[model samples]
Target: MRAMAYETYGGTEVLRETRLPLPKVAPGEVLVKVRCAGVNPVDWKIMAGGLDSLMDVVHPVVPSWDVSGTVERLGIDVPEFAVGDEVMAYARKDYVHGGTCAEYVSVPVRALAAKPASLNWAQAAGLPLAGLTAYQLLTRLGTTADDTVLVHGAAGGVGSLGVQLARAQGARVIGTASPRNHDRLRGFGCEPVTYGDGLTERVRALAPDGVTVVADFVGGVLDTTLAVLAEGGRHASIADHTVLGAGGQWMWVRPDSEDLSTLGRLADQGRLTVDVAAMFPLSELAAAFTLSQEGHASGKIVIEV
Candidate 1:
C-alpha cells in the first residue's frame, strides 16, 4: 500500500509518498479501502510537531484521523460491519497502524458509521471530525429550540455545520463570518455578522435580548462572547479555551458512532449540506495540507485516494 508518512515529525516536506505494509485488521476492527480522506488542522499540527508534549507521552505518529471509505475486510470480532459497506469514521488518533492518508485504514467498529447514501465519498469524508466536533459542542451547551445561539467562524467546517444543526433544532442562529459569506450563512438560516472590529456590538444590535449560547470556533473574541451571553447562558469552543474564563467549559470532541450516525441522517435527509471547497488526489496530500492551513477555504478540502 502507498501512504504518505513521515518517520520524524517536522513539516509538510517531511511527508513522503512511500510504499508501506498494509495494516492488519485487529479484533473489533475493520479494514477500509480508502475512498476519500479528510484533511484537518490537527493533521498539519501533528506534522509540525505541535503536539510534541502529548506525543512524548504517547508515540510519534502518522497524521490524519478521519476517513470515508468502504470496508474491504472485517475482523473476526467485528459483527456490525461486513465487507463492502460504505462507511465514514473518526479513527482514534493514537492508533499505531497510521491513519487514513493511505489506501487503507483499520479502525474500531465503534468509530464507524454507515455513510449517508446521498453523499459522495469526498463529501462524506469531510464530515466526521468537523461534524462530530460541532455536534458535541452544541449538545454540551444544552442548546434548545428557544435559544438564540451565536457561532464564531460560522463559515468554517465545524462552524458551518454547527449553524445548520442549531437551526435544525429550532434555535435562532447568529453567525460570524466575512462579508462574502453572509449569503451562505443566511442560507443556513443564520443571521450573519461580519467579524472584526465591533463584531459584538453588531451582533448585539441584531439581538438586543442577548444570545443564549455561544459556540466559538474561532477564539478571537472570547471576552466579547462572554459579554453578550445572557445570564446562566453557556459557552463552548472547539479551538482555544485559554480565554474561555470561568463561566463555561471548553469542549474537546470525542469520536462517537452515535453522533456520526445522527449526522449521517441529517445528510441523508438533505437537511445538512457539506460544501467541499476542493479535492486533491492522495498523491498531492502535501498541497492539500498547505491549502487547508492557509485558512481561506469556504468549505472542507478532501484527498481522494
Candidate 2:
C-alpha cells in the first residue's frame, strides 16, 4: 500500500510517500479501502511531536485520523459491517498507526458509522472529527430550546457544526468569526459576531441576559467565555484546558459509532452539512498538512485517496 509517512517528529518536509505492507486487521476491526481522508490541525501537530508525551508513536507514522471509505474485509469478531459497506470513521485507535492517509486503513467496528447518504466522499470524510466534536460537546452542555448558546470560532470546522447542532435543538446561536464569515454563519441560523476585541460585549449585545452555554473552539477566549456566561450556564473547550479550572469542561472528541451515525442522520435530513474549503490528492498530503497547520482554513481540508 502507498502511504505518506513521517520518519521523525518534524515539519511537512519530513513527510514522504512510501510503500508499506497492508495493515493487519485485528479482532473487531475492519480493513477499509481509503477513498477520502480529513486533515485536521492535530494531524500535522502530531507529526511535529505535539502529542509525543500523550501517545506512543511507531516509526514512519501515518498522519490522518478521519476516514471515509468502503469496507474491503472484516476482521474476526466483527459482525456490524460487511464487505462493500460505505462508511466513515473517526479512526483514532489505542494508538496512532495505520491512519487514513494510506490507501487502506484498519478501523475498529466500534468507530464505524454508515456514511451520510447526502454527502460525497470528500464531504463525508470532512464530517467525522469536527461533527463529532460539535455534537458531543453540545450534548454534554445540555443545550436546550430555552437556552442561548455562544460559540467561539463559529466559522471553524467544529464550531460551524456546533452552531447548526445547537440551532437544531432550538437554542438561539451566536458565533464569533471574521466579518467575512459572519454571513456564512447567519445562513444557518447563527447570529455572527466578530472575534478579538470586545467579544463579550458584542455577544452581550445580542443576548442581553447572558448566554446559557459557551463553546470554545479557539483558544485564548477564557476571559470572554467567563464574562458572558449566565448564572448556572455551562461551558467547554476543545482548544483550551484552562476552561476546566474555571468550572468548564475540556472536551476531547471520542470515536463513538452511535454519535458518528447520528451526525450522518442529521446530514441525510438536511439539518446538517459539511463545509469543505479544499481537497488535496494523497500525494500532496504535506501541502494539506501545511494548510491545516497554518490555522486559517475555515472549513475542513480533505485528502482524496
Candidate 3:
C-alpha cells in the first residue's frame, strides 16, 4: 500500500510517500479503501508534535482522522456494514498511528457511519471532523429554535458548518467574518458581522438584549462571547479550553457513530453541506499540509487518493 507518513514528529518536510504494508483489520474494525481524505489543522499539529503531551506517538505515523471510502473487508464481529458499502468516519484511534492519509485505513465500528448519498467523495471526506465539531458543540449548549446564536470565525471550516446547523434548527444566526466572507456567510443563512474592534457591539446591534448562545469556533473570542451572551445563555468553545474555568463547556468531538450518522442524515436531507477549498494528490501531500497550517483556507482541504 502507498502512504504518506512521518518517521518523526517535526514538519511537513518529514512526510514522505512510501510503500507500507497493508494495515491489518483488527477486531471490531473495518478496512476502508480510501477514495479521499480530509486535511485538518490537527493533522499538521500532530505532525509537528503539538499534541505529543496528550497522545502517545508511534514512529512512521500516518496523520489524518477523516476518511470517506468503500468498505473492502470487515473485521471480526463487525456486523454493521458490508463489503461494498460506502462509509466515512472520524477515525481517530486510541493511539496516533494507522490514520486515514493512506490508501487504506482500519476504522472501528464505533466511529463509522454511512456516507451521505448526496455528497460526492471529496465533500464526504471533508465532513466528519468539522461537521461533528459543529454538531456536538450545538448539542452540548442546549440550543433551541428560538435562540439567537453567534458564531465566531464563521467562514472557516467548522464555523461555516456551525452557521448552517444553527440555522437548520430554526435559530437566528449572526456570524462574524471578514468583509469578503460576509457575503458567503449570508448565503449560509446568517446575518453577517465583521469581526474586529467592536465585535461585541456589532453583535449587540443585531441581538439587542444579547444572544442566547455563543459557539466560538476560533479561540480568543471569549471576551466578545461574554459581552453579547444573554444573561442565562450558554456558551462553549472547541478551540479554547479556558471555557471550562469560565462556566462554559470545553468541547472535544468524540468517535460516536450515532452523532456522525445524524450529520449524514442532515446532509442527505439537504440541510447541511461541505465546501472543499482545494484538493491534492497523494504525492503533493506536503502542499496540503502547508495550506491547512496557514489557517487561511475558507473550506476543507482534501486529498484525492
Candidate 4:
C-alpha cells in the first residue's frame, strides 16, 4: 500500500509517499479500503510536533483521522458489519499509526458508521471530525430551541456544520464570517456578522437579548464573545483553551460512532451539508497540508485515495 507518512515530526516537508504493507485488523476492528480522507488542522499540528506533549498517546503518525471507505474485511469479534459494507469513520486516536491517508486502514468497529447514502465519498469523508465536534459542543452546552447560538469561523469546516446543526435544533444562529460568505451563512439560516472590531456590538444590535451560547472555532476575540453572552449562558471552544481556566468547557472531539451515525442521518435527510472546498489526490497531500496549515480554508479539504 502507498501511504503518506513521516518518520520524524517537523513540517510538511517531513511527509513522504512510501509503499508499505497494509495494516492488519485487530479484534473488533474492520479493515477498510479508503476512498477519501479528510484533513484537519490537528493533522498539521501533530506533523509540526506541536502535539509532542501527547506523544504518549499519539507516535510515527500517518496523520489523518477521518475516512470514507468500504469495509474489505472484518476482524474477530466484529459482528455488525461484513465485507463490502460502505462506511465512514473517525479512526482511533493514535498520532503514529492512525492510517487514513493510505489506500487501506484498520479502524475499530465502534468508530465506524454507515456512510450517508446520499453523499459521495469525498463529502462523507469530510464529516466525522468536523461534524462530531460541532455536534458534541452544541449538545454539551445544553443548547435549547429558544436560545441564540453564535458560532465563530462559521464558514470553515466545523463552523459551517455547526451553523447548520444549531439551526436544525431550532436555535437562532449568528455566524461570524467575511462579507463574501454572508449569503452562504444566510442560506444556512444564520445571521452573518463580519468578524472584526465591534463584532460583539454588531451581534448585540441583531439580538438585543444577547447570545445564549458562544461556540468559538477561532481562538481570537473570545473576550468579545464573553461580553455578549447572556448571564448563565455557556461558552465552549474547540480551538482555543487559553481562557478555559476562567470557565466553560474547552472541548476536543473524540471518535464516536453514535455521533457519526447521527450526522449521517442528518446528511441523508438533506438537513446537514458537508462542504468540501477542495480535493487533492493522495499524492498531493503535501500541498494539501500546506493549505490546511495556512488557516484559510473555506471548507474541508479532502484527499481522494
**Model 2 spans with C-alpha error above 4 angstroms:** none
TM-score for candidate 2, residues paired by index: 0.99
Model 2: weakest 10-residue lDDT segment is: 289-298
Whole-model lDDT values for every prediction: 0.87, 0.93, 0.93, 0.89
What is the overall TM-score of model 1 with all chains considered together?
0.96
TM-score of each: 0.96, 0.99, 0.99, 0.97
Segments in model 4 whose C-alpha atoms lie over 4 Å from true places: 57-59
Better of 2 and 4 by lDDT: 2
True-vs-predicted CA distance for residue 273, candidate 3, Å: 0.5
Candidate 1: misplaced stretches above 4 Å? 56-61, 95-97
lDDT of 2 by residue, 1-305 (tens): 99989889899999999999999999999999999999998988898889989988888799999999999999999878899999999999987777999999999988999998999999999999999999999999999999999999999899999999999889999999999998899999999999988888899999888999998998899999989999999999998999889999999999999999999999999999999999999999988988887788989999999
Which residue pairs collide, candidate 4?
A: 58-95, 59-96, 61-96
In candidate 1, list every pair of residues with a backbone clash. Answer: none
Native-structure RMSD, model 3: 0.8
lDDT (tens digit, per residue) of candidate 1 on 2-50: 8888777677888888888888788989999999999889888877778
Winner on lDDT (1 vs 2): 2
Q: How close is candidate 3 to the true structure, as a TM-score?
A: 0.99
